[model samples]
Target: MSLYSRKAARLQLNLRKVAVKGGLAIGAAQAANAALQAAFIVILARLLSPADFGLTAMVFPIVFFVTMLQEGGLTSAVIQRETISHRELSSLFWINAAIGLALALLLCAGAPLVATFYHEPRVEGLTMASGGLVLLGALAVQHLALLNRNMHYGRMAFIDVTAAFVGFIVAIAVAAAYHSYWAIWLRGFVTIAMTFVLAWLLSGWTPGRLAPVSQIRDLIGFGGNMTAFSLCNYASRNLDNVLIGKFSGEVSLGLYDRAYRIVTLPLLLINAPLNRIITPVLSRTRDQEERYRNAFLSTLQMGLLVTVPLMSFIAGNSKGVILLLLGPDWIDAAPICAWLSVATLLQLAGNPMGWLYISQGRSRDLMLAGVANSMFICLAFVAGLPWGALGVAKAYAFCAFLSTPLLFWWATRRGPVSLRNLVGAISPFALVAGCCLVVVHLLQRSRPDTGLLFLMELLTASYATMVLTLSVTRTGRSCLAQAWSVAVSGFSMMQMRKRSSYG
Candidate 1:
C-alpha cells in the first residue's frame, strides 16, 4: 500500500527515483547553505561580539513573529489543491502582498515598543532596518508555493542556494567593512533581494489577476487551520527567545540562541529537505488510506533512525562540539546544547504526525494539537523561569518528550507505530548514548586538563560508529544502500558536469 516499500515494484520504483533525485538536489543545496552559514557564523562571531550576535538574536524573534502572519499556509494550500486555477493563484499572491505591506508597517511601528521590551534602545533601528525582509518574503510566497506544488525542487534548490549565498556574501562583506550591526541588517536586505531575483527567474508563470471573492474565500478557509497550527508552532518554538531576552538580557539571549542554533542545526538540515520532498508526495497519495499509512510509517522510521544518533552524539559530546564548532568563548553553552539536543531528538518523533494529519485532511486536529503543545510549553517555561536558561531548556525538552505519545496517538488512532515501534526506534540510539556516557566517565578517570571534552568526543564517535555499523543488518542495510546510492549518484553527476565544462 505504501508507495515506498523495499520491493522493486513499478510505483515504488518510480517514487524512489523521484525521491532520490529530488532529495539529493535539495540535500546538496542545503549542505552548501549550511556550510556557508557555518562559515559566516564562525567568522562573524570572531569579528563581531556575542553582544552583536545577541542583538541580532533579540531583533529576529519579534520580526519572525510578525513574518509568520505572511506565511499562513497559503503555499501549502496551493500545493495540496489537486487543481489550482490562475484566478486562485493570482488572488493568493495579491493577498499575501497586502499582508506583507501591512506587516512591514506594523514592524516599523512596533520597533520602539520592541526596543522598550528588551531595554535595548539599539534594537529599534536594527528592527526597522530588518523589517523589510517580511515584505520581501511575502512577495515571493505564492510564486514559491506554486513551485512546490509542482514538485519542481531541482529549480527550487538552485533558487534557494543562490539566494542564500548572496545573502551570506553581503553579510560577510558588510560585517568586515562597517563592523557594526549594519551587517545583520544587510543580511536581511540582501536575502530579500536575492529571493526576488530567484523567484522571478524560477517561477516562469506570473499572476494575471486576483480571484473572485468566493474563490478567495474558499482557499482561505482551506488554509485557515494550517495557518492556525503554524502560528501556535511558531510561538512554542520561539518562547525561549522571548523569555531569554526578557529575563536574562541580550547577552544571555545571544548565548542561548547560539546554543539553540547548534542543537537544532541538524534538524533544520533534515527537515528542510525531507519536508519539501515528502509533503507533496504525501499529498499525492492522501486519499489512498493504505498508501498514506505506509508512507507515513516509512518517514517516521527514517526520521527516528537519523535523529537518534545525531542527538545522542551531540548530547554525549556537547562540550567538545561547542568548543570545536563555536570556539572557546561559547563554553557557557555546553550544558544548554546538550539538553536541547536531547529535546530536538525527542521532538523528531512527532515530526511526521503533522504531515500525516495534513495529508489526511485533518486540519482541525493539526491546529488543536499545536495549540495544546504550545500551551503546555508556555506553562513549562513559566514554571522553569527561576532556573534560568538551562532550566528553561530542561523544562522545554521534558514537555516536548512528554507530548510525543499524545501526538502519536492522535496520528495513528491506535494503529501502526504503536508504543513498541516508538520505543524500538528510539531505544538503539539512547542505549548507545548511555554506553558512550559510561565510556566518557571511564576516560575521565584522571580528568585531564581538557577535562571531559576530548574524552567525550572519542566516546561519542566510537559509539555512533558502532551504532551505524550494526545497522548493516537486513532492513538497515537496504536503507543504507539506498542512501549510499543517492549520495554516489549525486556526486557523480556533479563530477560529470565539471568534466564536461572543462573539456
Candidate 2:
C-alpha cells in the first residue's frame, strides 16, 4: 500500500482503539457508580424520609440551571475544535471560573425564592447549601474538556469512580449521623468538589494570562448556542420535579424523584460515555462521510441494544423492580417508574443526535430543536400537574413518543446522516423492544405476579426472550461482531500505565 493509505489506516485503527477503550472504561466506571449508588439509596431510604428527598428536589431545577451556565457549553467547543492553544484554554478557564462564582452567589441569594415558590421552608437551606455546586461544576469543565479532547477517557473514568466513592462515604456517614436530606445534598456537593480538585491535578494544564475575547469570539458563539440548547433541555427534563414539589407536595415529589432515578440510572451508564466520545471522534471524521455516518449509526445500535430491553423490563415490572431496589416503602412510586422507563425508552432514540449536530458545528439547529422539544415536554408537565406525579410521567412518555420522530428528522437532515439511515438504524432496536413488550404482556397473565421470585421470573423470561431473538436478527449479530472486534483487537495502549500521558 502507498504510505498515505497506510498512514490513514493506522490513524483509523488508533481512533477505533481509543474509542473502544474509552467506552469500556466509562461503562465500567458508571457500572461501579450505579452499584454504589444503588447500595447507598437502599440504605439511605431506610434512614431518610421521602419528605427529606422532596426538600432537595425542590432546589434541583435551580441548581441544574446554574449548572448549565457554569459550563457555558465551552467544553464542547474545546473538544470539537480542530486545534486550540494554551492561551485559548486559559481564557476559557477564567471564563468558566467567573461564571461559577457569579452563579454560586446568585443561587445563594435566590435560595429563599425557591423555598417561597415551593411553600416549603425546608427547601431554602437546601438551595442555599447547593450554591457551591455552580462553582465546582464550572471549574471542572475546561479541565475535563481538555482531557476529552486528548482522549483521556480512561483517566476521566478513574476520576469519576473515585469521586463517586468519596461521595458515597460522605453521604453514608452523614445519614448515619443526622438521617436528613442534607446528607443527600452534601453527597453531590462533595462529589463535585472532589471531581474539581482531581480534574485539575490529573489534567496537567494550568491557566496563564487570558487571551483577548476577540480571539475566541467564534468559540463563544458556538458555546452560547449549545448552552441555549442545554438550558431548554434541562428545563424540560427537570420541570416535572419543580412542578411536583410545588403542587403535589414533598412526599409525592420524593417518590417521583426516586422513580426518575430508577429509570435514568441505566441511561446514565450508556449515555455518559457515548456522549463524551461522540463529538471528538465525529468531529475529526466530518469530511469522511462514510466513516462519520457509520460511527454515529453503529454507536446508536449498540447503545440501544444494551439499554432498551433493560428499560422495557423495568417498565413492565416496575413494581417488582421498585420493591427490589427501594423496598415496599416506595411501592407507590411504581407507576411513575414504569411510565418514566417508557419515556426513557422512547427518548433514547434521539439522544445520540445531539452530538451529530455538535460535531457538524450545527449548534443553531440543536438550539432550535431543543426549544421545540422542550415546549412539548413542558406543556406535558403542565397538563399532568392536576393529576400528580404519576400523571406527569404518563404525559411525559406520551409526549416523548410523539416528539421523537421530529428529533430524528431535525438532527439528520442536511447532515452526513439522513432520515432514511436513521430509520434503518432505529428499526432493529424498535423491533426487538416491541417483541420484548409483547412477551412481557403475555407473561403478565400468569398467576403469582408479586414478590422477589415473581420479579426474577419475569426479568429472566424477558431477557432470555430478548437474547434469543437478538441472536437471530442480523443487526444483533452485527452488534455482536462489533463487540468481538473491539475485544480481539486488545490494543496495548488501552492500559493507562503502559501508555504515554494523554494530557
Q: In candidate 1, which residue ranges exceed 4 Å CA deviation?
A: 1-11, 414-503
For model 1, how does the per-residue alpha-carbon lDDT over 1-503 read when each residue is reduced to its tens digit?
56554443565556655766787788888888778777776777767777887888888877777777887778777877778899889889888888889888988998999899889899999888756788888889988888778778899889888888898988998889889867976777787778877886788978787778886675687678888988888888888888877888777777788888777776777776788887787777765555655665556555555655666667766777677667899888889888887788777767767676666566778888889988998888877768888888889889887887787777666433355555554455455445555554455444543535564556556556645654745445554555466568667767887899999
lDDT of 2: 0.86
The best candidate in terms of lDDT: 2
lDDT of 2 by residue, 1-503 (tens): 99977886787777887888888788789899989888887888889989988888888878888898899989988889999999989999999999999988988898888778877888888878887777888889999999999989988998999999999999999999988788998889999999999999999988899788888998999999999999899989899998898889999999999999889887788887888887799998898888889899888877887887788888877887888888889999999999998899987887888889999999999999999999999999999889999999999999999999999889888888999988987786777777777777677666537677876777777767767776786877777688567666554545554566654
**Each prediction's Cα lDDT score?**
0.74, 0.86
Clashing pairs in 2: none
Candidate 2 wrongly placed segments (more than 4 Å): 1-3, 444-457, 490-503
